[model samples]
Target: MKGLVCKVCGYVALDGNKEICPICYAKNVFEEREDAYKMPDFKAPSGETEKKHIPDFTVVEKCGLIPGTGCVDVHVKIGEVLHPALSEHHIQEITFYIDNKFISNVMLTSSINPAAVIHLKGGTKGKVQVIETCNLHGKWFNEIEIK
Candidate 1:
């Protein structure tokens, strides 16, 4: 993943361009990152390290909390093996994107589980991407198609 990252707050701009850092509100502090995120290699089997860093998704077509709202529930977990949540090393945040466009983000602490659920608009269909940043592992992302 080639993108622009905020030098101050590590906010990634997947489009490879950003004038200001969205997280830190810093201008002219964005730098190009050749490996902004880590994606699972489909051709190779994932090891324990990959399982601990890669994000997982579970999509529900209907919103259980708000029925009749026509919202799609997207559940995101940090990893299949469940990464450790310690004061030193933990999942810092999880970001949502639809077709490479920004949607929402969830900031986390070590006290809680590294997971989040975002509700999308009705009839939203595209490549739903989830990116999670670990304090030790940097960043990892996974995508799923919804129709």
Candidate 2:
């Protein structure tokens, strides 16, 4: 299993040739034999995702305050707004709460975006927990957050 990486996970595929990573199978795997880089037409930004504004989309990150205390960030649409100060030409909000207590709100605007919020923050939490994200629809296509 030395060079074995999950086709869908990019992690060492412990079980071999499977579309899913043994580790992420239950939580992130969509189907067997799926490519990590390949996204279905429905999930990608092709149809309704591009034209409409998905609301209340959130990403939750966890920390030490709770065993799984997390923070939530978002991916929203800019629709038709322009701001030189913002980088991605789009705007998103982050509704943050920890241990069930309301915290401060923040904004995320960037030109360079990477990883599915689920993929990037999926397993990022650790012992005593640090960060966990729960995105409503931004996983593979379109979503928004308003904090």
Question: Largest TM-score belongs to which candidate?
Answer: 1
Candidate 1 residue-wise lDDT, 71-135, digit = tens? 88988887889989999999999988888777787899999999999888788899988889998
| Candidate 2 local distance difference test against the native | 0.30
TM-scores, one per candidate: 0.92, 0.20
Lowest summed lDDT window (length 10), candidate 2? 126-135
Per-candidate clashes come to 0, 16
Scanning candidate 1 in windows of ten residues, the lowest lDDT window is 14-23
Candidate 2, 59-111: lDDT as tens digits: 44442233453443333222222212234333343323323222333344454
Task: Report the CA-based lDDT of candidate 1 relative to the real structure.
Answer: 0.86
Candidate 2: RMSD to truth:
14.7
- Stretches of model 2 off by over 4 angstroms after superposition: 1-88, 97-101, 112-147
